[model samples]
Target chain A: MSMPYWRAAGMTYVGYANACAVLVRKCMKEPFKSQTATRERVHFKLSQWLDGVPQQPIVRTSDDGGGGGGGGVGKK
Target chain B: MASGSARPGSMRLAKLLYGNVNSYLSSGAAGINGGGAVWGSTTGLSSAELAPFGARSASGQIVRNRMKSVKSIQKITKAMKMVAASKLRNIQVKAENSRGLWQPFTALLGDAPATKVDKKLIVTISSDKGLCGGINSSVVKYSRALFRLNGLDGPDKDVKYVIVGEKGKAQLQRDSKKLIGMYFGETQKSSICFTQCSMMADEIIKSNEYDAIQMVYNKFNSVVSFQPTVATMLSPQLLLGDQEVTGDLDAYEIEGSDTKEEVLQNLSEFQFACTMYNAMLENATSEMGARMSAMENSTRNASDMLDRLTLTYNRSRQASITTELIEIISGAAALEG
Candidate 1:
């Protein structure tokens, strides 16, 4: 299953993980949020996982030479 | 014959007294002489009598103008103090939040082998603007001290500088022009972001010049104080080298087919960017904190100046009024005589 939300928005996996770490801290509350050591450990582990993820290949589509004709021209 | 002699003697006495008073007024003792002395009998006194009052009024105008200008400056400093206080709040939060991304890496890198290399790159983080009370100078001073300690101040030293702000660049260039490598101007919004750190990292990586990179920055201690700090970014080779990792490096399993070297390289680069980002955030927070305190001091100083100027203005104004009143009362007495 493809997870669109997991895709990094114009950032490398490391950048994305760092950003997530900041967000996680920002979203947390009270004592849990204040635990910077745990948060840093999570950040380090996230970066490691992101480092292991396989990079997606680029997909390219070429235009057919049929010009203005629809599927009929290609079929003919 | 005795009566005629008495009238003449009285007239001579009055004339001598008038001459003495006129001489005293012309001497400008009270700075109340202006235009001419009021000769109640239609013959005005000489211009010398008017000079003292002219001087007094002119000085009074100067005091008034100074008071007005100082008041405006006080307003500006007060506004600046408020703005810096607000900005410090936000940046302090950001600095606190970004700590999670780099603290672990810093802990790991702390155990890395310390190898002495001749060539070093010192990244000095400072702000473009100056009104913030020794924030930039502290970093510059720390960098210079490091150069001195490492014998890097001389021409034979292989140290190079990457100055982030204009203030540090302007200062460090005086020490040695040849030591400067790259300079980044102030950000467009007068604030720093992670992208800027990433860009700086890319530039440093591309240079491939130094064996070790050290960052000199102001560490935010509190709203009123900051300290100059140094952090070192270890190279990938140095990190993965025979030096035993002190932290929990064994806990995370590397699953990729990529070689350990490639993984280490990527991780190091990411770590470098993260460290730079953290430094930038912390430095920005420090800058704002310093600025807030500096502006607070300036605002207080401006208020003090206003108090002094207002006192002088009031005193001068009252003196001028009293001088005028005395002149009018003495003139009336002279006319009555």
Candidate 2:
């Protein structure tokens, strides 16, 4: 089976789905748009551990208000 | 001399830890030999009867301390219960909505039991954080049972694992360490989304070639109950091989320039994501429900222990007060005589 346009672009399904989800979120009107934005807001802190001690954590955040929607949330 | 006194005190503490209240009270006589100053309270001290009273006050102190700790724990569990309850309400609604995303696909594809698959991938869904009752363990247990049932418990079996949370990974790593192929976590920190599910699905598909995928998760039956369930997704090759020539799927027509094989392939991949999305949402809802009930049970247990501890403390206090009163009355009688 041939790969979809997304898989052809070397993008995982998450990137494609997130792009589609952001697009849908942008097209919404009024109260829902704000609600969707609020719900979609992703913020998390990640820290690397050496030996048994935890290092300084870095906070990753995503806000699609400016239409720059896609940000990495996947951790493997 | 110091060792002699410390021995009985440690024994009393050990008894208290074991919750042997009867033996704890009976062991009061051990304090007589040490001969301390009635725990710093010399009220009506008649030299001969000092030890029992000293031990009583000490035991009372211990009981009070335990009660304080139990009360604080109850408060924490109570707060956790409220938090889980509120989270459950929000996630349950979303879970209900997500149910719609997968049903149409299942209807179109024809839900088939994967019995003849040569290779299998089992996805065990759990939460990263615990204190959510046995939901994580139950999923782990169920997955292991699946392994055992399919004769995949051997060292080299046809089945592999894709653990979706830290809790499941930790649990499965003990025995099935070699079987785990992929691990994903940090899901509990943020709310689950379709995009996240799709990402996991895509990664899982790329990880290996499996004829069948089984998702093991807890189904939220209600606020008070959850059931361990398995949802199966067959590979496109299996779907095509097992599909009947004139099945219900033939009723639908292909609209675009995409051929039948291309359409089926794309639909299968999309359906894989949808199934994962639904399973994650259900597992999340079940996690909340499990946590709420677990916290509720913990709070109840704390309250029960508190009640028993309070009673013991009050009784000890009353006994001390009665001893003082008896001493005062006897002194008065002797002086009058």
Candidate 3:
């Protein structure tokens, strides 16, 4: 795939993602658009990722024979 | 017989006086008339004795030369204005496009709590080229105000600076030589790019000298208006510091093996680059806008000067022609007599 303009322009992944997030926030409609809290939440999340925050494990499977049954333990 | 002798003697004296006057007149004494009226009535005098008419032609030549120079200057100013206008349009679009990257980042920073730091780095953005109306001065003024507000004056001042552009460096060097940590002069030589911003960020980050960084730049408001603005970018320590951790921090979930510290470091670097890039874009746009207006003013002034010069040239030319005509008519009248 061709490099994106921001990347070609030397924007880091965090920078590019942050811009996309902001653009997304701007396009949100109605109640979602008016909700500053949600927008801030998105901004916060995007910033965290942009800051290179490590991804949390989505599912932590138990190793004690209850593996499949306790797979959803780390969900937040 | 005695009366006859006396009359003859008187006539001889009269003839001698006339001969002396004729000789003087032939020697170009008519030039001393000072343009009032050439003594064209003296048959012994030549038309060359009319020095004022010749001087008028010389004066006309000087006026024509001045008008020519003004016309060339007007052409140059008009071309410069056109070039600036086109550049302004392109830069404005770029500035607008980059808004998305920085606006949200700004909002996030805005909500964060302020953490006081001892050593602050201020980055002043301006362009090397001037003749733009106070564009560089505005940033310089903003930086000065920042120093004053933070009490960053005198020997004990803890503020440091990273100045981008020769204009800002030259201005700030007068007062803040000790405070300038680094200077970037090449960015304004050509259009600024993210690579330049990255290089600047690396320098600032590698120095590991300051607690926080602030960018002072001219923000493009419109073609005719711009304002010096300050955008603060927190250092890694400040970004991850407990004091700056807001309620919004709980909304994000990190992934992978990277620790918060690593993430913060990377984030700070990325944010630094982004912020610098954004500031550069805005400053570039503002510079172009300022230049466009400045060039427009110059072009207008040049045109005004050309108009005035043309009027003077025409008037002088007409005056010379009238003088010559009067001289020729008087000379002809003298010849007829």
Candidate 4:
């Protein structure tokens, strides 16, 4: 009973994380960089931050857009 | 005193882990306790006894689990939509840049006019991969329908179904007997390449196995859709409404003789290759479109499933706890009686 819930939770989190990762990237992006990328990062992270950020993600990362929370987004 | 409270807690923990002993527990309740239903751990427990729990939990679990999973799924799907949108922009750019090559290419494939063009060959292009809405099936369906349209459904003379995609051939299982040749995957390795597909087309042409070479595949329209289309890959001059082949032999149509024949032959060969490239790219687009849609839908369904599951877990746990409370109260009542 709990197994399916967790699995769905894992999937939901993984999916949520995917979106959060995107949002985080935007939020993490340096404001000094391109406006669009920066705005996207900002948009992504803000919603994620508001949604109550997940403590951890099972999947390592999304490697597309040549951006996986690197450079500006990765900065604390 | 602390030990007195700790003893019941320990017993509860044991029951939670070892078995569903006290509450007339069912196997479905165990679905939460263990990794999954497949595990033997769920065995022996009577789910039948907990029919009320099942009925109640099923709905409540489905509802709450759906909501929680949704908020998460919505966020995820929204991200995927963005990702698909971005990838789509690039594919559109490439398709647009390559239009110069495809426009003239399709123009060369004159409309399916006149019944004189019999003895046809259909080169059905399909993606090597899967998870695309209905590209493979649509191609197979259209190919079968085309066969009917051609008035060439004789068992003695089977249509040479030249399959270009690994998945496509598989989908055309019903028409396996009709498949004369097959090709799989990208044009990288020597084992499965465009050279092989082209060779199949050429050999069939030289053998006079088929009079007209037609191709059916999805033309990538946009990121969201791919339209299945059939285009003529090769049209022999003699078959293009040219009645009485022997009548042209004595005619004065030999002005440039060798050059005209030479050019036409090269055009036929080059035309075949260009079509193959077009098909390969178009098929890739189809794969991408289908995968994107499938993933998006999966993301959504997962959310709904999660909602129901979580709800069940909570209700099942609550019902179990409530039963424990009732048991203690009843024991005291009996003592008073």
In terms of TM-score, which candidate is strongest? 2
What TM-score, computed on C-alpha atoms, does each candidate reach? 0.67, 0.77, 0.66, 0.53
lDDT of 4 by residue, B1-337 (tens): 2233236768877777556443325434544554333232333324432234335454444455456655786676557656655765665555556446556745544444333344677777776655456778888888877777766545454455666666765666444543444333343222222233333333334344555677788888865678888767544464233343224433536443343333344445556655655665576666567657766676666666666676666777788779889999999999999
Query: Can you give the lDDT of residue B326 in candidate 4?
Result: 96
The 10 consecutive residues of candidate 3 chain B with the worst lDDT sum are B35-44
Report how far residue B333 has shifted in candidate 4, in Å: 6.6
lDDT, ranked from best to worst? 2, 3, 1, 4
Higher DockQ: candidate 2 or 4?
A: 2
Chain B TM-score of candidate 3 stands at 0.78
User: Global lDDT for candidate 2?
Assistant: 0.73
Q: How well is each residue in B262-323 modelled by candidate 1, as lDDT tens digits?
A: 55666777887887888888888888887777777777777888898888888888988999
Per residue, candidate 3 scores C-alpha lDDT tens digits across B275-329 of 8888888998888887777777777777787788788878878887898899999
Categorize the docking of model 4: incorrect
Off by over 4 Å in 4: A1-76, B1-92, B113-115, B152-158, B185-209, B239-258, B329-337
**Candidates arranged by TM-score, highest first:** 2, 1, 3, 4
lDDT for each residue of candidate 3 in A6-64, tens digit (9 for 90 to 100):
54664544444444554666677878866632222210010001122322312212223
Ranking 1 against 2 by lDDT, winner: 2
lDDT of 3 at B71: 81
Task: Find the candidate with the highest lDDT and give its number.
Answer: 2
Q: Per model, state how many residue pairs clash.
A: 7, 0, 8, 17
The C-alpha RMSD of each candidate to the native structure, in angstroms, is: 19.5, 8.5, 22.4, 20.8
lDDT of 3 at B82: 88
The residue pairs that clash in candidate 2, if any, are none
Full-model lDDT for every candidate = 0.64, 0.73, 0.64, 0.51
Per-residue lDDT of candidate 2, residues A7-72 (tens digit): 687665555666778788879998898877754655333433233333464444454333433555
